[model samples]
Target: MRLFHFSEECSIERFVPRVKANRTNMPPVVWAIDEEHEFTFFFPRKCPRIVYTRSEGLTEADNHLFFGLTSCNIVITVETGWYDRIKKVSIYRYELPAESFQLFDETAGYYISTETITPLSVQTLTNPLDLLMARDIEVRFTSNLHPLREAILQSSLTDFGIHQFNQASAQ
Candidate 1:
């Protein structure tokens, strides 16, 4: 499988999960197969697309061709048909140690059902109880209801990397 991630930053050796408590802040790092997706850019007005490949993590491949410090063991792949999720959210999350991927699918019930949340306040709430737990929440992102989008915009971090992606080859 050859997946892609487009980003403004040049470095992505370590896949870090969005740690803030929100819809898209859960484990695994986000990546995409398409470049035109709406969420590709962090700063749409000033960002450039830097491309990464799964081959960077593959051995027996030329080191010069690999773009960054990606390792073979940490790349996490999602099951097929989940591609739409990537398009809708702009990118998909890939958790390392792999089993953590299910925490997204299995724990959907715990997410809040509304985006009316104060974007600024979401950053301050430190307790899980403050999020108001649920049991079976299915998330769908509409233009206005994107907390993850707000989170990204609100974040102070400089690296807004969006890796380009394609279906992982069945090697």
Candidate 2:
């Protein structure tokens, strides 16, 4: 599967082959990113998606990889919303960093990073109703939460509902 890695220089469109043998079979697609790791872009696929996680080191799972190699614990969801008008929305950008050395057996001796929750509002297409028929308006921000996911999950129910919908559709 193809995954996007956001960086300052460029947004890497890496085509991680389903199999290790096909790694060298295809070239990757790279897009330029601004100084800030932020940009308004769309994947070639539908919204409410999960990209493969990033990892370092070796493991039986990593060694015997397939097209859908799960590594990082991150999931990004994109959905459409409506308020005064339709809004193209994306949210729930969560990153679960490796918590224990066992997670990355090869890098066990080194210090592992804690999970980070990055709440991102990638882009909002205004007046999206003209483009699509959907209407909803919900926004809130709160503190007292250690991670951003808690804040996000508490702020809006619409987003959470949409996330569930996406997951159901995928299955």
Highest lDDT among the candidates is held by which one? 1
Query: Roughly what TM-score does model 1 have, to 2 decimal places?
Result: 0.20
Q: Write the per-residue lDDT of candidate 1 for residues 50-125, one digit (tens) a residue.
A: 2222322334333323213544311112233343443333212221222222222211111211121111110111
- Model 2 lDDT at residue 29: 20
lDDT tens digits, residue span 1-171, model 2: 111222222222221213223234523322222221111222211223222222344344433431134332322333322222214332221221222212111211112222222222222333322322221211212221123333333432221212222222321
Candidate 1 achieves a global lDDT of 0.27
Report residue 110 deviation for candidate 2 (angstroms).
26
Model 1 misplacement above 4 A:
20-25, 34-171
Which candidate has the top score in TM-score?
Answer: 1
User: Would you list the clashing residue pairs of candidate 2?
Assistant: 18-66, 18-67, 53-72, 82-135, 82-136, 86-129
Candidate 2 accuracy as TM-score: 0.19
Single out the weakest 10-residue window by summed lDDT for candidate 2: 101-110
lDDT of each: 0.27, 0.25
